[model samples]
Target: MRIPFIFIFCLLFSAGKAQEFAISNYDVLWNSQSKNSSESMPVGGGDIGLNVWVEDGDLLFYISRSGLFDENNTLLKVGRVRLRFPQNKLKEGFKQRLNLADGACHISGAQSGLQSDVRIWVDVHKAVIHIDIDHSKATNAQLFFEHWRFEDRATKKKENNQNSWKWAPQGDVKTYADEVGFENGSLYFYHQNKKQTVFDVVVKQQGLESIKDSLFNPLDGRIFGGFLYAKGFVNAGIEEGNYINTPFKAYELKTAKPSKRQQVLIALQTGQHLSPEKLKSETQKLALNSASSAKKDFKNNQRWWASFWNKSYIQIPKTADTTAYQVARNYNLYRYMLACNAYGDYPTKFNGGLFTFDPVFTDSTATFTPDFRNWGGGTHTAQNQRLVYWPMLKAGDADLMKPQFDFYQSILGNAEWRSKFYWGHNGASFTEQIENFGLPNPAEYGWKRPESYDKGMEYNAWLEYEWDTVLEFCQMILDARDYQNFDVKPYLPLIKSSLRFFDEHYQYLAKKRGSKALTADGKLVIYPGSAAETYKMTYNASSTVAALKTVLQNFLQLPNELLNADEKAQWQGMLTRIPEISYRDIDGKTTISPATVWERINNVETPQLYPVFPWKIFGLQKPGLDTAINTYKFDPDALRFRDSKGWKQDNIWAARLGLTDEAVKYTFAKLKNSERRFPAFWGPGFDWTPDHNWGGSGMIGLQEMLLQDVDDKILLFPAWPKDIDVRFKLHAPQQTVVEAEVKNGKANIINVWPESRRKDIIIK
Candidate 1:
């Protein structure tokens, strides 16, 4: 039936209108896509700035750059500044390589020799990427940007003779030119001021070339070549004859200095030039506009992050785990960037990030684009990397979440096209590198490994299912705007496409039990390849089951009033055909799915809990959940992905399954360990650079332990330690903000906001 549109309780803030939540340590050094590689650096780099607390809000018209250089090396800054006109056209989507097109401008998506079409039409200040497109009637083409440049080597050589999207590093071309230049150690500029007005970009990184290049890769010349708006400054500026081209009285800053972070910020402020008095006066007359733009952006951004804390923040109190707060805080920061980075292009995931930041080799943490290894590509991973941000949706950090969803949506057409070309169908099957198109780069050092079974994990087959979960999760998290009817319409087709893959591939078992169906082998068989996560070569692993279950649930949960009866029935049959999970007895009582029931086993086997926690197909309140929980409890080590010494997976599993004390103790120890970086970030693993997957996952796990709203019931501290006496808030599935306090083993003072009543709020 039709799901009625109802207002979430309109929570009026006590602050009257606005609240400020300032982030420290990160220096608010606000900064500001994708592509190219031998082996794609799994998740691209753009999300770092946004999710890592690098922006004033998620969007602005400027780019932010940061870097660190040792005394021996010459590079000091990571990258630097650029500018844009409007903020609305800044669409956020992730790409495979450096996306020079309206989407991601990378070199991979071409049938090339050298290149053409995407050419440099430079003036004195900088060169403009001239990808000619039909002009927009209302305004400047939606997206645009600028960034600080410090390119070590930006080549002038053209490799092929066709249209291309990639940028190679500076070759032996030593000198800088006015049209296309590389000056100082870290700077690369594209002079295109003739189309626009007064010069407004930065010369910061260009000031830091004195550092050594031992650690910096000579070829990673995807330097800060004026950070982009994806849509470069149009035909110089705004095209003539446009109706909305009424110049809004802009300020042209004349800086009589080189550059510093503070200087760039000041220039940006002056360039926008909204006088304080004017702003104050506007606050009175244009209060709504102010509230929606600057004021609202600042307020909501703070509120958005603050709500993340209000919902189950865990501190070690006076225990050994003193660093819990910091680890949790940074973990929050990482996820936040994942939500922010895709302003108008793709969410950055790879090691060489989205904005053309330099790729370097370092011990992690401060390594600019952390984990940059040559033969292995950098450890800036994928799949598991995506799981890090999935929870952000229900956490209600919608601003950060929107770009990621947009990134996925923008690539749908390409994905479908690939599905048709590769699978002879129109399903959305993402390649191993989600952003870059085509295939594996032969240039990637580790492209071929005859000795190892894992040849760089380029198998793109399992992604359709992952994208399936993405669509399902997004439908649950999408704002009213994502859906045209205020329902899940925009995402329905994506979900249907994912389901189509299974319908064609899976066959129902001949002998079945009642309404339950099985795979032809009696085990739920996910052929082609198992769900890509868990890394170990296990066939029909639990991640696959989880994905299948989610797709089925989406179909069932789809509002009938929105879908026709026939479509609904088609989903019902598919759901029934899904099989029961296979389990092997652990010890004597508990049972767990065999790591590789049909294939080879490696890595942690216990992540089978995937179906329970992230998947939610079956859990505590469900029939066999307790057994599943016990199975995890028996050998929690089964879930450990990167355990060194003193590893204990039980703590994580406990928190995940609502076992309070055990989980807390284990989580705190990691924070307490001397192995981690000082302020908090964890590391030294293969794909190091402070794996927030562990830290962030712990935050969600702790939330579940203390106050899990199992099955949307708003249960408070359901498994909290009896002595802790804690209280917290959480954002529920239906956007319900539920709060509760538990003292002396009693969870009371419970408050629940039904859909008709709740607006955006913290559960506690």
Candidate 2:
């Protein structure tokens, strides 16, 4: 029976108090000020991220914006802002808090009888950062915009990891300087990418120079940066200083007189222009408009954050296990970090996103500038990147998944061109280590190449023939439709092209080796493939087969209007040809195999259990559940390779299989507080500090523990401890939202959207 919309609204509100309790309890409060940038709190929205911290008596923050790639493809920080209240230096009573509800950072300190409060927030509707300062006593303030890139700096040795030329450079790779100046009572800075960038280098290296004009180069003529200003502030000359191991030049601004209240704004702009003067003019205009509408913008920012928090939440009450509660807290904290780039032009990077600090903090040997992260800026490691995006589905953050989708959309033309020029095929063949312009990383493409080798393949051992990771993104695009009613129209081309590559390419490979393109049974032979960078040189990789089968099955489910009869038949035919997942008898129990056969293992990933997690071929109430469980428990490689760090998904698989004990053990291990003061700055674990994939995998595992889908039924507490009291709201397929709670070993359905979905709910 259908419930009235009015009745549903009432039910939703009756359960609102529990959600309120959940979202409000996770705000991070620090009684003392931070000592360095490593202890900073993350605050951002739209496409900007700021690392805010206090040191000695000064308030400081690092400015970072998404898509700020330079000539070397480095995601450079704009600069650091240092603010000092000369007469009101912090001496006693210092507090810094991340107010999760409003998506803002609040910092306050006292000196003798005077006190100052500073609120830093980013505008969700605009690329503007606002800092409002109010003092109990009138005091003069000094602001310094410190930029380390006053002149070109050559990246040597391992420092090259920050760019696309990781471990190998064709020539001297230098991070060019930025233009900085004080003008019209404000400080403005910008980096205009030079005409020649790593994009040009990679194109020439990969033998794509013939189709160079067709390639999409994001670095060409790109300019990014902004200006900072405050009313009643005047230029106070420039200062030079050294911070950690880096030397910087600062443009100083001082208050005209003592003041009790002040407002400062930093407006950022990014675009491709032939003229630097035109770009600066536009940036200044953005700054002026931002100042005029500061009040309205602040209100709108708060409203957006309010809606974001209210969309979904998971709360383990105070009485729950201490470790589990901490995991829940860290979950929200890391989600805040992901939300910083909700509207970015590019996907949130798997390595660091925008909150990475000085490299020395992550590795003492890496004494490079703040721009340095272990992985190259524009290099997308699809294996790690998928982990970052998979959790967004259940969190109801499908809208935030656009940049990632559009990322593939933007690079589709180039991906297809590579297929046509190299293999004479029709489809997009995206590799695992891809550049922003949709080609293999120049270094990973290998400078030491054999003349007779195939031009299409990356000449590296681990990445050779590894092309199926793109299928995960294709699955995400399809799932967006089922989960959120998202219009998958724009992404249809990407999805079809990706599927076509596997269909046509495998046949091409088969014809080269044998008399037939298909096996005796007519299924395409997927030989010389890879199983998640492990089980290399495989025959019929189970990961590839499962991914293709699942994505194809989902693609055909779309309405007839989106897919024509011919297209449907074509996809349906391909679906029929996808081979069944191979299995092995492990310890006398049948379990899914990584592939039909493999020569050797190269990486630590457990792709045999991939079907249990991302592919969903086996798990829960589904057939072959015991077989999948046996693989996780009995496979020697899966046992030896199981981990909870940096892109590891053992916790996710444990939850998917409804193994509550193992799920709790691994999920707690993955989401536990890091050694850093801010708990979510997870690692330089196989990546970089604030490991986004680490946090993303943790989020996926936690959500999987609470809710799961088995056919049409919504299984609640599938892997959750019955004794743990919790309240949560998460997304489900068919445009549904499940809101429920558990208290004292009893499950209660607080509300379910559409009312019809309530019948689908099953407490495990």
Best candidate, TM-score: 2
Assess every candidate by TM-score: 0.57, 0.98
In Å, residue 9's CA in model 2 sits off its true spot by: 6.8
lDDT of 2: 0.89
Per-residue accuracy of model 2 over 275-380 as CA lDDT, tens digit each:
6676667777877888888888888988888778777888886667888788989998998899999999999999899899988989999999999998899999
* lDDT tens digits by residue: candidate 1, 1-764: 12234422223331221122223322111112211111112111223231111121111222222221111111122222222213122222211222211111121111122111111111101111112222112222222122222123222333110001112221232112112222111112232112111000000111112321211221122222231222112223212121111112111222222211111111000002233334233323332232224323334434544443443222222232335444444443444334334342333332222222223212322222211221122111344445445445445444444444554555455455545443454456543323222122222212224454332234232222233344334443333222211345666666676566555433321122234335554444454344443334444556666666665765676566657889888877766656556677666765657444544333442456666656665554556767767666664445444342122234445655665566666655544332422222333233333444444454455556655545435555545665655444445555555555555555564444454423332233
TM-score of 1: 0.57
Top candidate on lDDT is: 2
**Candidate 1: misplaced stretches above 4 Å?**
1-9, 13-263, 266-344, 348-382, 431-433, 436-487, 506-525, 531-539, 635-652, 669-680, 725-727, 742-746, 755-764
Q: How does model 1 fare in lDDT?
A: 0.35
